[model samples]
Target: MLKVIFLAAFAVGTVLADGELIILNNPGSVHFEGSQATNQSFLKEVFTVVLGYTPKLTQPWDGVEIRDPFLLPEALVSIVIEGVESVKSPRGKHFPLNVDEVEEVTWQAVSRRLEERDTNNTLVRIRVGDGLDALGQSALGELKPNSVDPASLKHLSLNNEEDQKFIEELQLLRAIAQKIPSTVTANSKPDVYWFVVSGLRPVMDLHGKDSEATKEALKLLNDAVNDLSNAFTDIYNGQVVVALFTNDANKLRNTRSVESPRVRREEKAGELETFDAAAQNSSDNLNTIEKSIQKLATDTEGLVEQIVDALETTTQDSEKSTTESDLEERKDDIDSMHSSENDYDPGKPITLRLSKRYSANYPVIFNIFLWFGIVFFFSLLAICIAIAGMDPGRDSIIYRMTSNRMKKDN
Candidate 1:
């Protein structure tokens, strides 16, 4: 018996899941005729009676009509208000309040009313219809908070300076809500979630006549409407059942749904690829520089060894006179080279010295042939010294010396 009951419950739940559950917020009567009445009746029956969800109606006798009986798990509901209407609240008389505003404000009045009742469902998504276009236009251009009649302000009970400031903020919010656009493009997930808003109606009621206040109310209302519309539009674009109360429901009969916008995944992929390519190019350049540095270090070591050998050979005294002259001329250069020992690493520093005595002794060129021999020999030594302190390889004087010697022998 338990197994049979479980199976039966599962089947019913599956069937219910296939259709959408709609929650309607109707505070007043909306008259309809002809095809508009038919559509409203159809929608009401399908959403409330067929789907087994109750309509939240402030006035039951003035319930809206529905014409179509479509099963949609997701829906976009539009709230349409036709003309100027006022409702009495705790604060004062509120004018031009639409179904959307009322629903939001009512939900806030009762703590967690929607959430506690529909634990598994979300609040109905709402959109403003074009019927309120004239109101929105008036709010944008002609509304002013200071223009409200001071007589209507008598009902406001202000206890302190803070209360007045709070009232002012409420007036601003109401004006912002009024200036919001009616049509919204949807861009939300298909899942439904409840939204409860309060404190708006009282503010609207208090400052509805002030153009600035109305503009503020319109802006706030439009932001909320657009957010709800975008949330629904992101997921579904099919036909939606709209429930609204107006003197002429015929205006809402022709209301159409908007399609969801397309996302560009390809552009995102291209950007990722470009970033990866740049990273790889940078890595390759760094690797090349590292290898070049290693080669330079090895060549520098070889040049250091060549300089040490040349210094050792030049220091050997063949004659006493020649030794004294060479020592005196090379003293300054040797001292400078030794000072580099403390400044650089032992194996990294390159020191080069040319004998100053050679220049001083060969000041006169009376014996041209002898002078040429001395100049040539010293020039070769100077070249070796300069090359040891500079970059290595083919550009070095060592290479030139070897090549020239080889060519002379050949």
Candidate 2:
């Protein structure tokens, strides 16, 4: 995850190169303070004992002798090359590249030189692309360095294959990796670095301690290495990833710490409590709503029954026969009697007439009473509805229990 994060952060300025060299700490000169004579003797003795090959005094670049144990003497060759040295500094005298004692003599310088060479190669690519685009247009003129070019890279030319290759390689490298400064801590102190090699062989220091935060960090690094090794199948490829771990693990481990178990538990409990309370309240509201709906159903049924009873009584009264013929004749003489006697049919269609004329004539008086009645009735209903909605389904108990358990877990 960390690696992913880093890659994203520096995505803009990254490049990929064909052959990559990730140097964690540039191999620097080992300073052995003494006279030149003493130093030379020490180096000779050291190489003889360590390499099991006697080295003789020879000119610079001419490598010393080595006797192969398995190969015959005639077959095993002794190699030599050009060698030169000066007894004085500030003149032409110089130490070997990796053996320079200057603090600034680091792998970063070497890497940067390599990067710039790659960058030069990349510049050529831009020209190539531009040339391709202008194939039908203008001439793809030869490009050369301007007069303002620095001493470190005055010789590089766009036309030169070596220079072009260098730049191209650098551009490719930028695609693959970025020179990011990673912070690693040791004894609470930190060292900021630009190169974080993914793989290099893990070797113990003088104290035999792995470059890691602690014991746990070491174990994690080892485990990661093993996993990567198994997955890659290519040991060399696997080492690249391991290199990244080996260099940063110790510093990364020291700077980082894990959360305590108790704190995490408490946090979970609080969350559970909050959720439980909310669920319980919602359940109570649901139950209350259900009860109000039931009451409304009952009231509506009662009103229907009263209406049916009133209609039935009127019907019976209308059917009663009168004893006096004069009264019967008078009732028969009423013009609306026939219409009033019309049967209330349950199956047949019925028409109900509603008029706004009566309401319009007494608007002010009716509106006041009508609105007041509606508001008062509904207000009371709303209160009952609110209660029924609260615990209508009786689910609050279950919700509360579940909530409580969640709170504890949290």
Candidate 3:
């Protein structure tokens, strides 16, 4: 089965599996190198179960931490573009289109340019970016959408990372839907699964430390997140599992650590102290056992005396004399027991007894087979006898073949 590519915002590199794994990594947090991109990050378990692989994330072109890409049994294509900003609004429209526009165009180019080794191969494109504090919530009237086209996200100068991302994802999903044919042909092209990850680095870059700007970005980013959520729901309606995870480290740059309420457990002495006391008491038991050993020794001496007395009593009870008559009476018994007629002497050779021999009876099925064979033989003999009594007609083919008159006539 053709599988979809996963899009996850990776400050470094990440192991994301299946088209269903859509990770919105590092929305408004740090970029370039962050926790979300690590091998042990939030997406690790996600990759392990869904991607049918153990996650081993690494920095692009770095030798040290790269795991899954090298260890995975299947072949995978890895693409990395260095020093590319996810979203940045230029001064007074530097060229023509904005970041979102370029991203959409890039999708088209990637789809068309990657010449498939198999003509039926459909390309799956993944786009990843960080969110701007989150995204602008359009419903709250915080930010207005410029247009429904791809430019809608780009023109926002307000780079709501998720808005731009959702717009892009929606566009790609539609494209893939269009590429799919209603009636499956003998040779059908694989539908493309476009993955998108959007981040709010643009909002940070555009307006730094401005409270008003930050507030504006929050509104826009909120909307974008909602849009992304709605998009996920739409995708999930087709029976796809959509999961959302907030990375612990990516939530903020710096914050004071709060004292954990569970600290009391750590401070208290462990229940192991009771076990230790019991162990000490067990060691003390050796001394008590040693004290009892003296008493046990006395009991042992008494037991030995009783055993000796029992032996002497039995010896006295068995004291008796054998008579010459008794010997003579036993002589006959002894002779009978060792009689040569019995063939039980040590000088005699050993003999082995033979068991009876018998053949196995035929099974019921075999008996039936035997009866069938007899009936068949008799039936054939009767048929032969009946044929032998028949006279063939002169017009019959058998008579014509056997007659010399036919040859002569011919």
The best candidate in terms of lDDT: 1
Which residue ranges in model 2 land beyond 4 Å of their true spot?
Answer: 1-257, 317-410
TM per candidate: 0.23, 0.20, 0.28
Could you tell me the lDDT of residue 203 within candidate 1? 50
Model 3 C-alpha lDDT versus the unseen true structure: 0.37
Off by over 4 Å in 3: 1-237, 250-275, 281-298, 313-410
**Tens digit of lDDT per residue, candidate 3, span 1-410?**
12222122331233231111123321111111223322222232332223233323333311113233322211111111111222211111111111112233434533443343244443444443322222232111122233454333333442555345544433333332332332212122223334443334434454563445544444454344445434433433322222232222222212212333345554454556777887788777756655565556566556556655565555566474455465546555544543433333433457789886644444556789999999999999999997787677886657978898888999
Error of 3 at 185 (Å): 16
Task: State the weakest 10-residue window (summed lDDT) of model 3.
Answer: 90-99
Write the residue-wise lDDT of candidate 1 on 228-293 in tens digits. Answer: 444343434433333322222222222211111112455677888999998888789767766665
Over the stretch 1-410, how does candidate 2's per-residue lDDT look in tens digits? Answer: 99787445433222211111111111112112211111122232322222223323443332222233232111000000001111111111112221111112222332243344234211111112222233222221322212222233433443544344333332322321211112111121111112221212121221124333223223432343233223322322211111111122333233333434666788999999999998998788767766765666566556556645565565568575344564446444442433333332334557779664563338668889999999999999999887677763336754665675667988
Count the clashes in each prediction. 49, 59, 22
Ranked by lDDT from best down, the candidates are 1, 3, 2
Q: RMSD to the native, candidate 2? A: 36.5
* Reference-based lDDT, residue 104, model 2: 22
lDDT of 3 at 190: 24
Give the deviation of candidate 1 from the true structure as CA RMSD.
Answer: 34.6
Candidate 1, lDDT over the whole model: 0.39
